[model samples]
Target: MTMRRTDVVIVGGGLIGAWTAFFLARRGRKVVLVEKGVVGAQSSGTNFGNLRLQGRFPGQYPLSLRAQALWEDIEELIGDRCEFDPSGHLYIAFNDAEREKLEKYAAVSESHGLAIEHLGAADLARRYPWLSGKAVAATFSPRDATANPRLVTPAVARAAKALGVEVVEQCTVMQARREAAGFVLETADGRSFGCDHLVNAAGAWAGEIAQMFGEGAPLFPAGPPQFVTEPFPYFIRPSVQAVDGTVIFRQIPRGNVILAGYPRTAADPIRNRAPVPPAKTLAAMRHLTAVVPALRDCHVIRVWSGIEGYLPDMIPVIGPSMTTDGLFHAFGFCGHGFQIGPGVGLCLSEMICDGSTETPLDPFSIARFRGAVAEDEKFRREFDLPAAAR
Candidate 1:
């Protein structure tokens, strides 16, 4: 019955937990981060890696921008760039309706202090000669970027460890209960942790922890199907996405074009699996070729997916628990967590250490789930709700 005590215990090792641990450690807090598996082996490591600033939830701009600043200085902060590329993001519209959507999105982004360049068909053709002429309009965000998802979480975890945070991997928290002084977390391996504050950043599995505190969210698990083409000559500069949500692709400096398709695939968190169906892969290929005619003959080298939690409202639970003191949650990002991971961590650390953060996190409070959460329109378009939720 070895019991390790710490000032803070984070129950997930994905980007959010890693960043939170890092920030807490930087602030001189004795912290313990426990991960069921290796760091970033889940959604944090398998996402499309788009650090997109445009077309984000209006409420997320401040946080996203804050995270972007950290990312821009990543090498200085963590001594690793993790293949971050500020290649920008181009949102293309193939029809009038999609063009209007692009215009509106651009307006919203501009209002939020993001610079967006609206491009007409001719302008797009001139700027991106390889782009298909079918695109009637487009908007480009120069600050949008991409990074290697596989490298980020581990690098951040390593950085956290260098800063004196104890990172426990291959360990699962079997039970968590609040005590009078603090909280106690029991691990499957017969170790216990007592912490004054607890953070639930367990990705798709975080809802169960919330339930233990008498709070519940309509959080479901799903993953976007992703594919990468065999290395070809590098031509595409910016990450390209269709406004219609059919396909999004970006070419890395190494010449591989990584792409992600929508209508997220079903995920099984119990088994820790998110399989990419072959049919979905083929459809993604077709969509990719349709958008970029030059890639019509490109061969896909691999396909994959990762389990991610989705709330009905398509936002995340990112504030203190409603029923518990010293318990915070930052999960259910609905595939948009990567870019905001750092900011969420910094905010959580601020909340824990300074008692508050400047970011407006009221919209992400767990209290929102006390009432029926109206599904966001994007949720309907981006995911096939589970039968139980439907």
Candidate 2:
């Protein structure tokens, strides 16, 4: 059996793992990133790619804002733009309830230093004439953006490789255990890796790794169904979503309108499948047309989904493991991992190299699940929580 040693072994090649490897390598730490499949072939590459700031969990603003700054300067950091666009994000309200939600969200966002523009019905109609008349009010966050999820993980992996990090693809870690010296990971292909520190960024499959170390979380696997329409004349400039959470869409410069549906589809981690239901597709189409009347006739070209980990609380685990030493975790992103990938990587690197980070991560600690994790209100609304969590 071939055996190798490194300063850090990151099990998972998704965005968080790839970015962590890049940052760790930049800090002169010998790192090896292992993936069961090709890099970014999972949720990291399949998400809707919204870098939204207007409606995020208030506690995540610091990390999310830091991540947006990294994305804005992506070319300087990774030498690739990954089709990132700061075209803004528009949240529209269809009724009084949704308008109130938007107002609360905008206030919280403003408190976090995010600039928000509130638009009344007339202003929304005048500014976005293509919008349907059903939109009663709207909020626009100019700094929120979108990017090509299909391109981000691989590009970041390449950057990490360029910085002397070893990226091992299609190699699954069959066994991982703590040893006297550090942590030892055995791969499916009869290879062994020894590292002083271990990082579990394995996306939906990270729960298995955490369980192996005596820390288990109610991590459910699921994904949002996504679809893309055939190219049309470019018109919509920013990513847009209804405050009621039925649909979200954006028109790329190439004129293809990509959208994601709500009430996430169930995913099977063992089978590696996240199928987009045909009924969901039709419902999403109707919702999209209701938001933007111009898309009523656009033919959908393709549909897809990827597996992502969801916690009952709708937040992620992003700190040192409570059960073991020299171990860290950053998984269960619920479907919002793309924008904060870079910031998560940077924070993980700081925790490993300097033993702490300035960003507030106490809310994401693994110890929070020691008893019963109270399900977040959004989690109950957005996901069909597993019976175990309920």
Candidate 3:
């Protein structure tokens, strides 16, 4: 196979891959970013762009706050509007069980020093008069924002290209073998490359890629279906989350409402080629109507679904693997990567380019599963929405 060389090679040119390429290339590292299909074709583009902190794990709060700070200036940094709407996000609650859980979540998250404002139903209604559905209490994070991921992915990718990073699209990675020097990589059409280091930002396919080096575990891919509504004027401001955060809805700059399903699809059909299920859309609509009756008049313009790699415990796997040399990873986002992807890229780049990371890597390490039990049930319980709560 023909061989190429670079200081670093990145697999999967989605939000994470492109961001890492941008940071590393900015550092003057010769970088190559590879994508099997169009950029942001998977979870990066498919999920609701709810950049919020209403219900993130406490360990993730700090990174999210930092990312939100960066997102405030993302348009200026990328030279294009990703439609950064800093309209904030709200998490609503109605009952004892739900209220108790939300209060705990708010307390734990607030302990992280986030500026979370709690509101009763009257204040919530006064703030968002459109929310006529059932809810007794709410919490808001003004730092939460939303963006058009489709536009942002390609835009930042263009920036990476202009910065001298080589980005290859529609090039499938067939095999990856660790070499004494670094790694010898191959593409589907027989093209090959030798790099001093590699970043496996391959999303759902990262675990599979990691196996080529006999280092990473085969990750579980969770496939979730999502739907978007037709254009509606002045509908939703900040993204909205269920008290337990099952259903997340946010309107894009173009005025289309994006509604997330309750029971997120799992990693079955490795890749999906069908429109979102009718039942899924209907379920999301029910949640929307219950929260914002104004949505009852809106029409669903489009529906789509994509699979993302998931770990057993539902946390993302980020950082270098223990078994491999000069290799790093950022995958298994399980529907939470879009907002954190860029900061994750920065952390990965720091780890790879500087031999250290200032960001805490404990919560995202791959080793969390070495001797782990089936903790997904607990993870689901901890983060599961009250509506979906069994």
Top lDDT model? 2
Better by lDDT, candidate 3 or 2: 2
Q: Which has the higher TM-score value, candidate number 1 or candidate number 3?
A: 1
Q: What lDDT would each prediction earn against the true structure? A: 0.92, 0.93, 0.79
Q: In model 1, how large is the Cα lDDT of residue 129? A: 88
* Candidate 2 C-alpha lDDT tens digits along 1-390: 767999999999999999999999999999999999999999999999999988988899999999999999999999999999999999999899999999999999999899999999999889999998999999999999999999999999999999999999989998999999999999899999999999999999999999999999988888789999999999999999988789899999999999999888788889999998898899999999988888899999999999999998998999999989999999989888998999999999999999999999988998989989888877778765366643
Q: Which is the winner by lDDT between candidate 1 and candidate 3? A: 1
lDDT of 3 by residue, 233-328 (tens): 866778888865557788776778888776765444344452456777887888888888877999988887776766656678888877787888
Q: For model 3, what is the error of residue 22's alpha carbon versus the real structure, in angstroms, after optimal superposition?
A: 0.5
State the TM-score for model 3.
Answer: 0.93
Q: List the residue pairs that clash in candidate 3.
A: 221-267, 222-266, 222-267, 223-265, 223-266, 223-267
RMSDs, each prediction?
Answer: 1.1, 1.2, 3.2
* Clash count, candidate 2: 0
lDDT of candidate 1 at residue 284, scale 0 to 100 = 92
Model 1, residue 337: distance off in Å is 0.4
* Winner of 1 and 2 under lDDT: 2
